[model samples]
Target: MDTQTLIYIFVGGTFALYIGIALWSRAASTKEFYVAGGGVHPVVNGMATAADWMSAASFISMAGLIAFSGYDASVYLMGWTGGYVLLALLLAPYLRKFGQFTVPDFIGTRYYSKTARVVAVICLIFISFTYIAGQMRGVGIVFSRFLDVDITLGVIIGMGIVFIYAVLGGMKGITYTQVAQYCVLIFAYMVPAFFLSFMITGTPIPQIGLGSQVNDGSGMFVLQRLDAVLTDLGFQAYTSGSKSMIDVFCITLALMVGTAGLPHVIVRFFTVPKASDARKSAGWALVFIALLYTTAPAVGAFAMLNFVDDVNETQYSEVDDWFTKWEGYGLTAFQDKNGDGVMQYRPGDAFEGAPDYSGETGPSGERALANTPNPESENEVYVDKDIMVLANPEIANLPPWVIALMAAGGLAAALSTAAGLLLVISSSVSHDLLKSTFAPGISPKQELLAARLAATAAIIVAGYLGIYPPGWVAQVVAFAFGLAAASLFPAIFMGIFSKSMNKEGAIAGMVSGLVFTFVYIAYFKLVAPAANSADNWLLGISPEGIGVIGMVINFAIAIAVSRFTASPPVEIRRLVDSIRVPRGAGDAQGH
Candidate 1:
């Protein structure tokens, strides 16, 4: 079939599946809508959670980031997947036993403070919205490439689809749909990778292919060859770290902890039946997540190899047809720096047009090349990393149908995560903000209506921000992780694990952590006075890595303040103790 026909068929099939699941699993009550009736099979819930957590950032962008940035980018792989270990080991079972509908509920009831609940809700809304914005942008980017539509319209189409299932089914609807999405996205991601790996190294497994010797007559493995080639081109080594050791360590830690801390992901554990089941589900979720995570490094290596082979040593006029083709889609660009017919990929700032090759030597003391070699130029090519995933199948010479499936897969990833995030935001506003604080006497039906309203409003805001994303979608999503690590993870961990933690300490820690993280990110990323802002960043630690410091501050403040203030009440202690056991089946009440 033609690419467009296959895309229509694939996307149409996915939509039909989601609608069918939504209709069959339509939530009948508040409990059903909020937590899937609390009876989802552990294995199924684990798959759902994996789908919920991976997001478009993982499926569509992560390998691409690693591909270009090389070994320094291993932080993303380790941090994101390693977090599931922490969640499974430390939080999921207890949180499930707590039987709460949302993270804020646990905070509110455990801390016995409405103010703390509201603050938690505020942090959740900020983190979820910021993360969802990137997912929406990812959806738009994929659709614009495959469907041949404008990015703005793509975001609208994506929002419309999300509105249908998410608004109607809530967590119940999102769960099954996400399971299906996980399958589609993982399949789409691996097929091209497998093909490329086989073609490059005669091995079907990309993981092995990465370490296998290349067929380039060199005895070195693909990693070794890539490292050499990239260094030759003035890029960093492909298999070795490039970023500062501190930044790497800090960012990796933050990402792992932040993944465990994210409210949307944690709430998925509550939908399963037994506390022990939650533990089992978390393991399953990690397994499903590993299907993609383990494949990512191979995909990155394969993609980087493919990209280099496609563009390197080829004349300007001999560039692949894909370049001009993608340029039509506003993805690839080629500006001839020098009038010389041959394009030079070296570091150069004279990109006005063709530079004349004079016989006289230039500053480099060699024959005047067609391009001015500005050894320190940072602007060689500006391909967005987001393009890497969508472009992978095509770049590897895959079939048209494979590319079409990739389009559907990318959209599925973004939409599934969007639905999950929307559920969390809606639940926080309705269950925490309204029922706990403002409308304490509201009916269940009224509360359900409020949840839907909050979800609708959130989708609108997400769509607007999606259309006008502030920065690289992946980087923005990473910032959300940092914020969650700093603000929410510490408080939740202490609330569950620390017997003496009191309301004052939890609230103070959350406030301090939130403020510190916000200021750190804003100064480094948003501030325009480059020199002054650069000077203000602590120890030259980037905002994405500062979450580790913020988390430390939160733990210290919580511990110190708790020592000075009154301990948590007896009832709260009992609740905490109950949450640690496996036989608990009674409801602990939502916010």
Candidate 2:
């Protein structure tokens, strides 16, 4: 069968399966809607958690970022994985012990204040919306390329699919569907890696292929060859870091803490039966997640090597169909800057901004650009970093079925996380803002209806953001992580570990951290794009890394303010002490 036929089969089959699961597992009550009745087995929950954690950012964008940025992008791998460890070991079990449906639920009860709950809901909504924007964009990218649909229409299609499963089944439906998505995404990710590895290095294992010498007569290792090729093109060496040490450290720390504070991931723990099960599920999730994370660096290196080898200095008329297809979507473009038919992929911007196509063709039959070419640069190609992974299979000339599977995997990664984020938004609005605070007298049925309505509204907003993304998939996601680290991580960490952290302190700290981080990011990214360089950044810390400073400020201010304020009530302090005590330990101590 043709590639498009295979894509339809794979994507349509998966969508059918997801919708089927939603129907089979539809929630009948508020408990089922919120926590899947809190009876999920550890292993099942682990697979679901793995799927929920590995969003489009992980499956599609992380490898792409690694491909373009080389060693500097290692921060994402370390920060995200390390953050998972912090969440599993430090936060998941305790939050599960607290037995709350959402993060806001925990904060409200733990702090003994409805105001604290509202503050947490605000933070959750901000982080979730920012994060979901990336997932929705991923969906659009996949559909635009594979299904031959406009990006806007693609986003609407994705929004419709998510609405069916998420609104109908809620957490119960999302959990089981994620388990299936985890299987599909992991299989799809590894298959292409195996093919490319063997084709390039005569090794089936991508991890081994990364270190192996090239299959060609050249004896250089993969990294060594990549460094040479990139430097020859006036780009930085692949093995070296261009970012300052402080920025790297700060970005890594922000991502780590941010993962721990993410409300969607935290709520996954609530679906399990008990605190111990939460820890077990976390361990299982790490094992499943490692399958993809370990393969990402190898995939990135291989994809970059293939792309440069195939496209650089190639004649524009003879370029492959994939390049033209992506160009039609306004993602990849080539310009005849030197009036030569040969394309040059070099360092520096190819155009003043993203290519503004003239809706006409050049003499060389390449897409005509309306944007001004960069005079200082000889580059003639514009490649979006988000396209590298999805285009990798095509660049390497892998099988058509493999390409189809990749399309399905990309959608799976994106939709799973989108569902999880939407659920968090819905739960926050219905459970935290309405049921717990404003409309405390509402019945269970009313709350369920409100939850579905909130999810519907959130999907529409998510679709809009997806259609008009602020940045690349991974960049947008990084901003979300930074915001979560600045606002919520400190509050949750202090609420669990410090008995004296009162509502006033937590709320004040969250507001301060969130505001500082948001302003710094906005100033650099939106207000002054020309001044986004390291020279103008505060302490040489980029907007991406400023969350570390905001987090520090949150901790310091919370501690200082708490010292001056009244301590928590005796009951709240005892509740904190009880959560810290292990389940069997209390019984043993009594004996």
Candidate 3:
């Protein structure tokens, strides 16, 4: 079969599987909807958590970021993985033991104030919505390329699929569906890695392939060869980083804390039966997540090598089929700067802005650009980094089935995380905002209905954001992580660790951290893009790394404010101590 038919088979099959799982596991009660009835096995929940945690950023964009940014992008790998460790050791078990359906629920009960819960809900909404936008955009990219549809129509189709499963199955359906998704996505990711690795380095293991000498007669190791190629093209060496040390540390710290604080991931621990299971599931999730995390660097190196080798200095008439297909989507473009009828891929912008296609073709049959070319730059290409992974198989001439599998995998990764984020948003609205605070007397059935309606609304909003994303997939996700780090991590950490922390302090700290981070990011990202460089940044911290400072501000302000405020009530302090003690620990100690 041809590539298109194969994509139809693979993508259609996966969608069917996801919807069938949703129908089979339709949630019946509020508990089922929110936490999958809290009966999931640790292993199963771990797989589900991996799928939920690995969003479009992880599956579709992280490797692409690594491919382009090289050593500088290592922060994503370190921060996200380290953050999981923080969650597992410091937060997950304790939160699961707290027995709250949502993060807002824990804050509300722990602080003994409705205001604290509402604050957390607001933070959760902001973080989840920002994060979901990237996932929905990933869905659109996959559908646009493989299914040959407009990105807006693709997002609508994705929204419909997620709405059915998310509104029907709730956490119960999403959890099971994610397990299936994990299988599909991991297999899809690894197959190409194995193929490319063996083809380039004669090694099946991507990790080993990354370090092995290339099969080419020159016999240079992968990184060495990549460094040589990039530097020759007037780009920074692939193995060396250009970011300042402080910025790297801050971005990594922010991502770590942000991962721990993400409400969607934290809520996954609640689906388990007990604190022990939460810990167990977290361990299993690390193993599952590592399968992709470890492979990403190798895949990125191979992709960059392949891309440059295939496209750089190639004749426009002889460009690969993948190049033309992607260019048609306006993701890949070229300008004949020297009128050489050849495409040169180099560093820096090719045009003043994003490619503005005028619905016309050039003499060489390439898409004609309306945007003015950058007069000072020699670069003649603009390839969206997001397309690197999806185009990898096509660029390498992998089998039709492999390319099709990539399409399915991308959708699975995007949809799984989107479903998780939507659930978090819906639960915050229905469970925390309505049933807990606004309508404490609401019936369980009514709350369930409300949750479904809330999920439907969230999906619609998420779809809209996906159609018009604020930034690249990984960049947008990084901002969400920063927001989570600033607003939620400190609150949750202090809630469990410090008995003296009061509602007044918690509320104040969250608001201040959130506002500071949001304003800093907006100032550079939206308000003043021209001044976003290192020289203009505060303490030389870019917007992506500023969240670490916001987190510190939260910690400092919460501690300072708590010193003058009343201590938490006696029972609340006792409750804090109780959660700190592991479940059944007293029994194990013969208490």
The TM-score measured for candidate 2 stands at 0.96
Off by over 4 Å in 2: 355-370, 469-476
The superposed Cα distance between candidate 1 and the true structure at residue 97, in angstroms, equals: 0.4
Question: How many clashes in each candidate?
Answer: 5, 0, 0
Q: Give the whole-model CA lDDT for all candidates, comma-separated.
A: 0.80, 0.89, 0.90
lDDT of 1 by residue, 66-105 (tens): 8877787788888888888998999888888888899999
lDDT of 2 at 117: 89
Give per-residue CA lDDT, model 2, range 406-482, as digits (tens): 99999999999999999999999999999999999999999999999999999999998888754433334456877
Residue 362's lDDT within candidate 1 is 24
Clashing pairs in 2: none
lDDT of 2 at 124: 93
lDDT of 3 by residue, 83-134 (tens): 9999999999999989999999999999899999999999899889888887
Question: Model 3 — TM-score against the truth?
Answer: 0.96
